[model samples]
Target: MEKVSEKVRQIIQPGEHSYVFSKYLEPIAHVKPGEVVEIYTKDAFENRITSEKDLPSQILGDYLNPQTGPIYIDGAEPGDTLVVHIIDIEPDRDWAVSVMKESFGGLTSTDLTPMLQDPLPEKVWIYKIEDGMVRCNDQLNFPLRPFLGTIGTAPEVEALSALTPFNHGGNMDVPDTKPGNKVYLPVRTEGAFFFTGDAHAGQGDGELCGVALEISARVRLKFELIKNKEIKWPRIESDSEYMVVGSARPMEDAARIAYSELIKWMEEMGWDKFEAYQALTQIGKLHVGNMVDTYYSLVAKIDKKYTKLD
Candidate 1:
């Protein structure tokens, strides 16, 4: 086991696009898995909305979604697979606030009265399990599954907004981010600058509001490179006995994208196409990872025990 210590983490600066790799990725490449590295990340609002204690007329629109790092892996490169195994996520606390009736949230109802810009900058209400259940509103009983809502790097030649998940990963709200899961992201740059931020204490499929129970947390990730196997998008495998195929697009399109990839994967594993399709419709389930991102992503979870892996 590597010694556990807090590294002086930096927050991805505002107005910066295409996080430069040579500087950030080089350092993290040296750390071993099981070694804890504490990262400092900004809230999605990126200080646009201050603490819930006070409300503001307008939030700073520029510095939103400042992810932590484009941390480079030692042997990572384009056409290679960067596998990140999550060891643990220690959120300073287990709770977050959600604002209903906002400009881009799901709780906006036609009949609900709008609150003034001074009604507490949209409170992110959180709850504790004082009685064996995490109590939110009287009716809400949430199961905690803390995850990094945004985790990706810059695309090859452009400054892709952190708001979408392409062949390059970005704000993907796949709930499989819980501990003990490994995510395989395709590398597009020499170092594969990886940054992760926007943590959620607990959330459901399709982060309808484009947010989750927001919180600050520390993540332990083990990084390794799979050389020479080219992949297009992101894939996740977990001890939960499932392999996830993720794609970004409209819901239907995303499903088609993920499903198509699954078919290819099945064939690569030597399975019949007809049987794979049959199994997909019958036993496989499609999960809406996040819909609010510009290009929504759909994830299909395939049970590992039943599928052959090479």
Candidate 2:
């Protein structure tokens, strides 16, 4: 009798680094619930800022970000959903820090820095967790929930508008994309061109400074299909809730886009417009996805109780 084979596969190519995609490969044999798969990822710096001396070039040149893997999963098709379970995230280094350059950071014109006095290879920032609060420097402390600042797929064109999360998921910086969370992205092409980058050691809601801890990461994802369900934008289901994530030019407009998408979700779950609005109104809250990008993103989460049919 022939033995039944387990469907396990690795998506990324070996020993390759920075700005290159793994050549097309066969899809994973099968993906079932409770199954897990590990993915190797490159740091957001993309091997540009390896040493203290290499930091200057990292900020000045390199106009854009490069990501990896648009891995196609078996039995995944358009109008279906892909469940990306983030089981673990381990960084290569002990500490990760980000420095905001004078002209480049999100707060480009604010009084963020006292003065521009010196030029160093890179700036330094630190953190302290005490009394259940996470603090950067001495003034800011947030409940420490670190996430992937940049996790998305490629756009139709190779060179997407730098710093935006398009239909094909370029730079959607959602803080809730943390460990033990599941990010569901819409599949634009035959094999969803998935790319994961911008792993942060820690971050705030907006990533106001324009960067996260900026480190390399190790992650595991489990892909599953949501059949007979059609979603227009990215939707996520974490341990406790479901959210519709969308992006647009202005912040307020972005929030509306996300909210509208969530309404679609409500309708699909058999709620009328009034019922959907009421259900969402009770549980929905908007998130400032990423303000620094050219076009910002907003995610609307409809609490699990609203969607769970028991």
Candidate 3:
């Protein structure tokens, strides 16, 4: 609740963080639609693993992905669509961390994918961020592509952990939830308790090792509301593509949910359902969000040109 700027309507500090998304949590701040707010967030591990010497087994707590808010939008109600336009995301620190947990990640032996084999080694990699690049070491480096790993509205009755992603949009970890994109979330509860955190400097598809270049961030976002317009799943709009996200188990189910939702959206926009399905089969693109979370997330996307209706 520290006030950092007079220009920003609301400034939520890292102290105003939560581990779960629930309607029971008090609103940290309330804002009218169209207000620009700046939020400061901790990394996925809550900034616990600072160096390569810090291992997940020794430092991580019972919870991860500490979200920043349950910010109440003035007029948002059930069945409305909450639109969040990400204006910018700046890394608050010069370093980020990635880790490999013992019983986690895509290739490791997880509780969901049990195996007689031993667990993977618990290790951490600290990446240096300089000149807008994340340097893993002298041999590899990539441009920083910061995005929110967990961003969503609360569900009607469930108090879900920040680690899971589903219809309510927790921890989807989609790379598309970055700057210059508008994320549409379904509001199932009054006020649409919104929370976001788990900033990543960069992450590849599937979030391969179950971690990204986790970094603290200064995120600026604008909120808007679509009265009475209900969406079943999270949707994204970038400069040229329209995307829908679906989180489920057995990756293929996630893909089906994403594609099905996209087809339904196209139908609502006036395209015939069968034609839309056929068109999507030929031109749709699927991007893996995260294969490491409790549920895998897949994004179905199509370029704007193909979405233009006569």
Number of the predicted model whose lDDT against the real structure is largest = 3
Q: What is the C-alpha local distance difference test score of candidate 1?
A: 0.63
Q: Kindly indicate the candidate among 1 and 3 with the higher TM-score.
A: 3
For each candidate in turn, the TM-score is 0.78, 0.77, 0.96
Rank all candidate structures by their TM-score, best first, as comma-separated numbers: 3, 1, 2
Q: Write the per-residue lDDT of candidate 1 for residues 66-154, one digit (tens) a residue.
A: 66666665566788877877666666554455543234443442113354443323444446533333557777777667777777655
* Poorest 10 consecutive residues by lDDT, candidate 1: 17-26
After the best TM-score superposition of candidate 1, give how far the Cα of residue 185 lies from its true spot, in angstroms: 0.3
Candidate 2 lDDT, 84-112, residue by residue in tens: 77766666454455666544455554333
Tell me which residue pairs clash in candidate 1.
25-72, 70-194, 97-124, 97-125
Residue 213, candidate 2: C-alpha displacement in angstroms: 1.6
Q: How large an RMSD does model 3 have? A: 2.9
Candidate 3 local distance difference test against the native: 0.91
RMSD of each: 5.6, 6.1, 2.9
Please give the clash total of every predicted structure, in order: 4, 2, 0
